[model samples]
Target: MRPSSILSGLSCAAFAILPCAAITVDLTSEDSIKSAASTIANGMMKFYSGNVTGGIPGLLPGPYYWWEAGAMFGSLIDYWYYTGDTSYNDVTTQALLFQVGDKDNYMPSNQSKSLGNDDQAFWGMAAMSAAELKFPNPPSDQPQWLALAQAVFNSQALRWDPSTCGGGLRWQIFTFNNGYDYKNTISNGAFFNIAARLAAYTGNQTYAEWAEKTFEWTRAVGLMSDDYYFYDGSDDTINCTELNHIQWSYNAGVFLLGAATMWNVTQSDLWRERTLGIWNATHVFFTSQGGQAAGQIMFEVACEPNNNCNVDQLSFKAYLSRWMAASTKVAPWLYDDIKPYLAASAQAAALSCSGGDDGTTCGTRWWNNGVWDGATGVGQQMSALEVIQSNLIDRVQGPVSNSTGGTSQGNPNAGSGGDSNPIAMPAAIETSDRAGAGIVTALILVALVGGAWWMIA
Candidate 1:
């Protein structure tokens, strides 16, 4: 059976048990959102301190936690952008600095590069986030962040093996010792995003060119199928003969975001069209397929075959929501295609929440402790919440449009649509952004702690 068909069947089954409107879109105030963001942030911080960072208060664990860190940092940056909050910047900067301090240690001894695609990607993301914040009005020490990002770019660039696989990144630079082994869509997409973002920030056309080349290489190697679902890049021709066999949310998110960013800088119609296509095709995950929520559409381990639903799935969801929000900002015409999915995702997120003081529950159960691991599941839940929050804002405000005549809602600050309570919208939007940002920052710090704890255990 085609993977899409199989996923459709699974989703139908899951949705049978879930009410269509399980979640209410009543997140009307920024204060409420910010409060929730703060709760999530605190939970994340606790998780990091207890589990990932080896009981350390401020240090990062390593590559294992980098994905969560990068996601959280990205969310925080968005919060800073929306709210003009310097505190978010302060917290994010500190967390990033901690990661940078251990860069050399994380690098492989023999190759002087990152351990795997996740490391390169996450580190690259972290650097890009820092660069975005500091570039135009760089502080005295801001150059360090930009320089470190560039160094990571250089290291990751070296790991690209065009000869081994059809232009895909290796899973690792050293540890696996198999240079021409397995490749995955997430790796290539991530590298593409990192390179593209760096190119835009630096004004160097070379970075943009490299990003496009990597993107093309990914397409050529079968990481991306014609319909937009991704594949696990394995050389095991016997069991995994089809290149587009595996599809994951993160892969889609990374690829779509990368393509969009590249198009933004290069004005490449090819990239823009490809990104829009991927965005539309991947929307299947949010629909009611058969009867389930199509949650499995975001599964990544299909690439590894042995991998199962885990934290990465949650991470993928977070990435997808963020990508959707960001994309809507650039291409409002796509909002209608995206809004319903966001609504459905928000409902699913509400179901994931159980009764708690915070009103959000960790969706997955943790094996280590009969209760949810605060860092892993909690962060995932919060990430989903932020997406829901963003979607709510967009829907109520109406869609803002591009010059081509497609309309989407204007910025929340402009107060164009929605129920315009003079006192309500601004506070709600700002609070939501701040809360989400705070939670995300805390989650990153917590993931670092969780990684350390996991590593030591």
Candidate 2:
């Protein structure tokens, strides 16, 4: 059984009894489509902190909750784009617009005490996504769409300190968390992605410059390894020698899309090289051991087998899946190289969806034995959904055309950087590009499920 089709055959039997008639949840299932994993995660684990930073952990115990919600929301948008379900479209536009809050400032409204540069950057990526996708919005007094992303970008730019590794964004915007002394890859990579997207969307040269500068810094600081492995971050408290060796999926994922976007916009060999480099090297984030092969599996190497990923790390791979699906538009020639891996990974992930007290729960151990790994959460479900969606998205929407920066033929853009229509990569490199949730109390499960072009969600 191809992994991509595992869930397509899934039906109401996979989920708990719904309020309405049990609806099938393949690539269809209109408004009834539900990502209950996301709903439960959002409802139980996330709550508004009232624009401050410190309060209780809302519902979930943690330092950064809103940002997690933001990341999940971003994934939800990807789900929307790939599926084009539109059921979640209003949910996305409505909540995110509100989150942007007075004057489109995510920080003031989000008020996450642990709001690191990476945290805010997540929302920035989402906002850019909405703008590029041309998500409908009500005319508001403040900046609503791309401008909101710009606001976050500008805020980070103001705080960009040259003291560390020549130049980098701080981990935390505030000194409250000791993380302020650190510079992490996700922060810079997310920024790099946002810069590339903005440059592509607005045709702004300044954003492109920022993208190159950010990558150069990552390369210099040893965070972005020569082979494209994205190391965690540098600890200024340790004189920067302490390069936290953790390799998270989101780090590589962002750089993949960033390079893809820049390549599409600038048509430069530099960005093209970056696109291919990250695409090829991203296999390091996963494991190919125990009979699995590198570039054919999708385990979060840092937290698999024994160590389960934390909430933040849980949905990390979704970003990679999201961007890789998008990157195909900037370089259609990569379809042969990219889609199969996603399908195989998606199959492995689908096998992890165990039906139990928590419903149809999924986990992060995609390369484990055929049986489910007993891991469950919104992050897990989201991650599984992301990989599955990537492989089958074309079936529903058809192939995206090369003119719109995609080659899906009839399929719509699943957030492949919006309609500016990325230029197809030259035949030379012919490359390249580019979830879950949960809390401790068992897991939430549902059978049914839940997007766009040009700006993939």
- TM-scores, one per candidate: 0.66, 0.73
The Cα error of candidate 2 at residue 89, in Å, is: 2.3
Q: List the lowest-lDDT window of 10 residues for candidate 1.
A: 1-10
In lDDT terms, how accurate is model 1? Answer: 0.49
Give one digit per residue, the lDDT tens place, for model 2 in 210-317.
Answer: 887788777766677677877777766543554655576778888888888878877878778888899897776556653655558787765554443456666677
TM-score, prediction 2:
0.73
Native-structure RMSD, model 1: 15.5
- lDDT of candidate 2 at residue 428, scale 0 to 100: 21
Candidate 1 residue runs with Cα over 4 Å from true position: 1-32, 50-66, 82-89, 101-114, 133-143, 175-180, 236-244, 289-308, 355-359, 364-379, 392-457
Best by lDDT: 2
Supply the global lDDT for candidate 2: 0.59
Tell me the lDDT of model 1 at 227: 67
- Residue 434's lDDT within candidate 2 is 6
